[model samples]
Target: MPTEYHDLSNWDIGFAALLIIVNGVISVALKLGLEKKLIVASIRTITQLSLLGFILEWIFQQNNWFYLFLIILFMTLTAGYTSSKNATRFYSGMWINSIFAVMVSSWLVTSIALLTVIRPETWKENPAQFVIPLLGMILGNTLNGISLGINYLNESLINNRGRVEMLLTLGATRWEAARDSVQSAVKSGMIPILNTMSVVGLVSLPGMMTGQILAGVPPLSAVKYQIVIMFLIASGTALGTIIAVVLGYRKLFNSDHQFLYERIQKR
Candidate 1:
């Protein structure tokens, strides 16, 4: 195991400013036009993470399942809302489904992992710490997958409407007609997790592992935790994407089994 890691001091962060200066200089030299956004993003990152750190500390101190669950709900809703913004541009009535899908899938996967695979003594005992962070991570990735996959599905449906209609007219079911689009969209959502898994430990040290090792955990223990986190993310992303895409595909068609092309257009 590694020795206790050195904690960052106020002075330590000054070094990070140099990286920001370098980035800003490059942006100016190349006219990348990202300086303002970069600065704003940096500020937001610091503010949000600092706030979250305090909030998590409070929740940890409380040691109450209710507070933990409430935080989880907030995380789920926030993630759902963020992803919904991406999807709402292409379809109506999607935000609600996105929220529902994310809330359900994230909670389900988080619960399963907490209850079975990574079971703690009880919610109040030893698992709340594990539950919140793991759930947040799963929800974040799931949100990305659902948003990207839904966009892909929407675009696929629009681009291949004629082919879909031909299949529909040839006695194909709605599911059959939209099969390719669904598959493509689902694949799009799942690819990130898959790629990450493929390259984990080889190409990169995952955030969880890096954080754990930096916190002085044994490498093998951190690896085990990272493995659990990765699998949980994959499961949550898959379930969320499948639910969102299936629900989203249904919205692309009407009650009469006809493709509602206009639904794919901005409302």
Candidate 2:
């Protein structure tokens, strides 16, 4: 194992942060698009990271189960917020769906991966410090997939109402009629992830691997962790997206198996 490198304290974080402001200014002067977005993003990132840094320090000190539960609750809320942002009004109760999907898929995959794969004797020792980041990334990626599935399902059911009606007329079940649509939506949503898999090492180094290496974990172990996380992400993405798609389909269809195109409304 490599020795811990805590050299960043000597470096001026403020000076590095100033570069972001400079870039935003340059963007405005050059008429580049999204200057406002860049400014907002920089501010939000700073604020959130700062707050989370303090929370993490406190969490490390306490190391209590209640704090762990709070972390999970916050993750759920964040996943739901992201899902709700892109979700249609037609998909009522989508927050509930998002929470359930992220929680179930993340925990299922993480538990299995930990127990059967890593098998750390004391699982709870650094769960908040370690597992939470992995779960957050998984929840975030899964939310992206769920957004795609929900949007695609809504548009398809709206555009192909005639087909849906015809299926209903022919006694086809709601699930049967919309199965292909949901599947396609899921595939489309997951395409970026598939592409990421192909370029994981060649194009980019993931955060888990980078952080582990920086914190003195062996390169081989970091690589393994990265690979496991990517697989777990894929698993959670599929599960969460499927859940959203299925629940959204149920919401789109009614007792008579008819398409509810009229129900979708802009909020």
Clashing residue pairs in candidate 2 (N, C-alpha, C atoms within 3 angstroms): none
> Lowest summed-lDDT stretch of 10 residues in model 2?
5-14
Judge candidate 2 at residue 104 and give its lDDT.
80
| RMSD per model, one decimal | 2.0, 2.4
Q: Candidate 1, overall lDDT? A: 0.87
- Relative to the unseen true structure, what is the C-alpha lDDT of residue 68 in candidate 1, on a scale of 0 to 100? 81
Could you give candidate 1's per-residue lDDT for residues 1-267 as a string of tens digits?
Answer: 489977998677778967997999999999999999889998998899989989888988888878987888888888987776866347877888888889889999988888787766655474567888888899999999999888889888988999999999998888889999999999999999999999999999999899989989999999998998899999999999999999998888866778888877753
Clash count for each candidate, listed in order shown: 0, 0
Stretches > 4 Å off in candidate 1: 28-33
lDDT for 125 in candidate 2 is 75
How many angstroms is residue 166 displaced in model 1 relative to the true structure, after the best TM-score fit?
1.3
C-alpha lDDT values of all predictions: 0.87, 0.78
TM values, all candidates: 0.92, 0.89
| TM-score, predicted candidate 2 vs. hidden true structure | 0.89
